[model samples]
Target: MIAKFTPVLLFFGIVSCYNVRKHKDAKVPGNANDYLDYVLSLARPIIASSGLDPIFPLPEVTGTFENTILGVHWHGNVALYNGFLFGLSTLTRAGDATLEVVGFRMDFTGDVGLSNVQAGYRCHYDVQGVGDDADINVLIPYVSARFSSSTFLLNTTTTMNSFQILNIGSPQVTFQGFDGLDWVAEAIADIVLDNLGEEILEALESGISDILECIISVTSSDDPNLSIDSCVPVRNVKVIRRN
Candidate 1:
């Protein structure tokens, strides 16, 4: 039913795993390349560890679908479980080390049931529908991001640009075992899955924002007088979704 799944779990999955700290062997970055390398080294763990297990499973999700032309409406709950997002790896710098990317792969399963459903035109009808199981998987080969710096008032401010997902693969979203009105169930499922790509991308973008914030913190940690605020603007992350 117009899936509109926000994927709050996906965002926190990466953010919760982050532990920003300078390695014992860490040295001050002398150049742009060095700075990026340093950031990557610090970011590896956060990316690799995100959603390795069913840390967050969405239960009791409610949604609705309505088609005025067909005079059909459905409202119900979807319980998503066994949510696992893994295969986050192969983080590397793009050409000239100016752009960076991290791999992405995720899958989840859920139970769907339209406890209250209604369909009508000239004649009105209502019934309960059950969608037994749903399995969703997505593969975005890589998410690329760029970092830039500008000096103002003798303060070098680092800014991270929006991220782009590359080589986006078709997502696999399927629904099975509907107890009533096969076409209605399919229509409802379709509405939900249509927004999956955008929602997933938003979640990953939030994770990247956290990584950049951590890097800023660790980079300036060595100097007590320096704080992340001085070198990075508030909420330095901004992502623009691209079709």
Candidate 2:
């Protein structure tokens, strides 16, 4: 009878060991929300320490505007320089996301340009003057982006799936020139936006990609399993704006 019971006890012991092994080999459930949070959290500190936020001393821009009002010719040439961009913020949402879909909104502000302007009105008398130190404020609205990522073995890469400009904010330009005529300032602002819009978006994308690359590189350096080089490309990204 003791020999017969020994076989049953042996079977139970073998089954228990197999169950433990199975549990050990099983993969943990993936949590994309946590993944997003972790990476973004790491990014903030890295960006702060690296001094990548609040870009300053923007490139200078110049434009000229001419028009005929009531047969009186009006013209001006202006230059804007020494701009700064700040107030960078990201809009986060509360929801569960898969590894395939991650989205967020980015917003910032720019204080651009002390200007030097030369304007004149010609009809009967010549009115020529120079204005100094114009004030301009650029309000960058929220831009939404959708990104996707995949991990194979120890490598991971993120791609910019899509982006949209929800609203385009107008720049405020105050040029105390032409004896209180603000239209020149407005025209100059329009020109600035046309060029600066593209530049700002490009800078933003590059900056973000660099931050992500830094995060991955630092993390991979610490973990042997994730040491492989990975690229995050954000090129040729199209923008869709709301009508």
Candidate 3:
């Protein structure tokens, strides 16, 4: 009788081990975009309650010179070559959610010509945990273009362009105890575009700020009492721009 029961006990032990391992690897479902959408959905109420914009428009990407031109020109002499806008797109991964953004293109057809310019930004988030409290790491990789041109006589044009992929190392963000019921916390992407032109650098900084604000607003809730121990805000937020 004991010998016969031994197999059963061994089988049960093996099954328990497997279950434990599976649970250890368990993660929230869907890709980065889906996760972000879900987070935003939860944050809508809090955002509305805080009297802030509940819905924010995703960044737009354009190639037209007119579209690229903005009042605040970070670099370049030509008005048409001043600024560029890029569209956001979702990139999917099997384990973690990786987002690839493309198309920060600009073009100029005036007396001072700016053409064939392109740029891109990529972001990745590793989301852990269920419901409100989740840990996330954001990585942003970017690239841009370099151009050269000379003035010419009547009906003459000179153009030189080269594409260089800037290696901006991964920026890591770790969120601890991010439950919606508790105090909110967030990590923003700090990108070092020192090698790239100022326009691209400014764009990255603006994007990071937007992301940080949204994350903070979404994670935080109002607890006027200040007595609730769990209601305390998350401590120690570190932002780094890698080159």
Candidate 4:
């Protein structure tokens, strides 16, 4: 009887350990949209107190494309040449708790004499912390564009040019934990761009700046329960143009 009971006890112990491990590994189930909804629900009051937009405006987004061409000819004293231009645009929303970015948008414009143009742009933010005292951070927003064109006034010719918004500085902030604990931490996120044009680049920069300012003004406000200790802004904007 004693030997039989010992084996049964050992089997129960093993089962308990397996259950504990499974619980530890279990994660909260949800997608990006669900996470955003949870954060917004907890941050509404804090955002309003920051003196920013009382009602966070959901961003409006859109995009478009255009192509154009021109030609001329002259003989002996005659020359022939042709050119074409294409453009695209995109608008989006970005932000987090300690930091919130909105009204994010970009436009791409390219000129080509006799060639095809391609481009893409992407923007996203990272948020860290738990509950209301969470902190939101911005990595770096960027844009890039390339153009290829040709001429045939006298002979076939091709030219290629590329540009990028660079020197992206990081932005971050720390908020008091909701439980009023002294625990503090930091987070980071990044904005990526590929094959974009100048007009779109400028639009994207302006939109990102606006969103950052809004986040700073709102998150930095005074709260009786939770308060901000410090603040910093990004410096040194970089732009690169290449062939």
Candidate 5:
């Protein structure tokens, strides 16, 4: 199970613990809704185009269970560049103390490759698989935490209730690995490939963190509470080109 928690708690912890600039009569540019819209305008694009598809290269893989192994290595890269379309299907309140995010999807086409690998039970594992017309659906639920500025509970992480991944191109991966002892790479790939959902979740978490940080940096604000009226808002979404 992945987590849907956001970095809102980090903002709150920093803001509440320290002295946040209180705009007594801060020329409130707009209401809470407007502020949210403004922030979203900045965040949406960054989230959509954050850390994407370098194929996450792993030169040396290491893990431990009973004994430690070394020199686990790999060659070849997974090409995960994309032609994806992003959208916020729905963002609403769940029950009493949670934020529900649904319809956040990424439609992608990429490749998965692992030409060589050396591990305990597996060696020389290789995959030169292509993934096309694949999509990812995410349902994220966040904890209800208050920040320093507004009553917006949408951006904090006190803890996570859950993070769900509905799909990931439903990629059909084919590969083979052999230790020359008596095992098929397909067997291990099956186990790893079957859990692609976790991979998608991991990517989403990193992307969201980047998006939130981008919003904070561009807005020049510490509190992510939907209360600050950003005069120099990030990028006027009006002129944003999804190219």
Candidate 6:
């Protein structure tokens, strides 16, 4: 419950209770952000990223939550898939959440299963960047704190739909000692990033291509209802490279 808990079952279909916490609102992105759809690619689809939020984890969600639902308690947290530790290919937020995030920290316990330890995945190195004009606007779980469960806690200190939007005081991520096995957790992050680095890059490229195509298509479309001029150029892109 961030604003008003509507039984209308909107925004994650929460049929529970919540108190909408109000904070200093941001410059609510213009519908212009929708133009990011123009940068879409089939190899990497924004819709794919859309399917990621609140499922509970990195590149999907970055928030924290604690509440009782259906008369049962639940807890969950998320972290970004940076080069250091790996849980996902790229850091992406599922673009379909009602509550936005500013910034936050999350803790983990038990087996996070964040990496593919079987392979020798470890910090190899990676670099990625997103352009400023490429403004991307998606509802993402920014701030979160959880142990090991399936509930999202979003933090909204500063929000960014594209990489350029990130700043020194943007969202913060942490995966601490879990089940007293800090070493194990560290190992997993390394491996996941090492093994999946290339894959992640490919996916990102595909996704960007798709967004671009979408914009071009609509711009050239015969439908008067859909026009390129209507698209607000929104791009949240990151470039990750490792040597």
Best by TM-score: 2
Candidate 3 residue pairs that clash = 61-86, 61-87, 133-178, 133-179
Model 5 over residues 18-129: C-alpha lDDT tens digits? 3243321222112223333444455444443432322222122222111122754332222221212222212222222221221211111111111121111112233333
Give TM per candidate.
Answer: 0.43, 0.55, 0.21, 0.18, 0.29, 0.24
Ranking by TM-score: 2, 1, 5, 6, 3, 4
* TM-score for candidate 4, residues paired by index: 0.18
Model 1 ranges off by over 4 Å: 1-37, 48-55, 58-61, 64-82, 87-90, 94-131, 139-167, 174-195, 220-243
Candidate 5 segments whose C-alpha is farther than 4 A from its true place: 1-50, 58-123, 126-163, 175-185, 209-243
lDDT of each: 0.35, 0.41, 0.26, 0.24, 0.29, 0.27
| Count of residue pairs whose backbone atoms collide, per candidate | 1, 0, 4, 9, 6, 45
Q: Which residue pairs show collisions in model 2? A: none
Question: Model 2, stretches more than 4 Å misplaced?
Answer: 1-30, 89-97, 101-129, 157-179, 216-243
What lDDT does candidate 4 reach at residue 50? 34
Evaluated at residue 226, the lDDT of candidate 5 is 35
- Which numbered prediction scores highest in lDDT against the true structure? 2
| Local accuracy of candidate 6 as per-residue lDDT tens digits, 13-130 | 2211222333322121222123222222221233334322111212321223244558865443323333222222223232422322222211111110111211121122111221
Worst 10 residues of 6 by lDDT: 105-114
For model 6, the local distance difference test gives 0.27
Off by over 4 Å in 6: 1-173, 176-183, 195-202, 221-243
Better of 2 and 4 by TM-score: 2
Q: Write the per-residue lDDT of candidate 4 for residues 1-243, one digit (tens) a residue.
A: 001122212322343334334443211122222332332333333333332211121121122222222442211111101111122111111222111111111111221111122222221211222222122221223223222121111111212123234322232322222232222121111111111233335433443223323322223222333222121222232232211
Candidate 2 backbone overlaps, count: 0
Query: Where does candidate 4 have its weakest 10-residue lDDT segment?
Result: 74-83
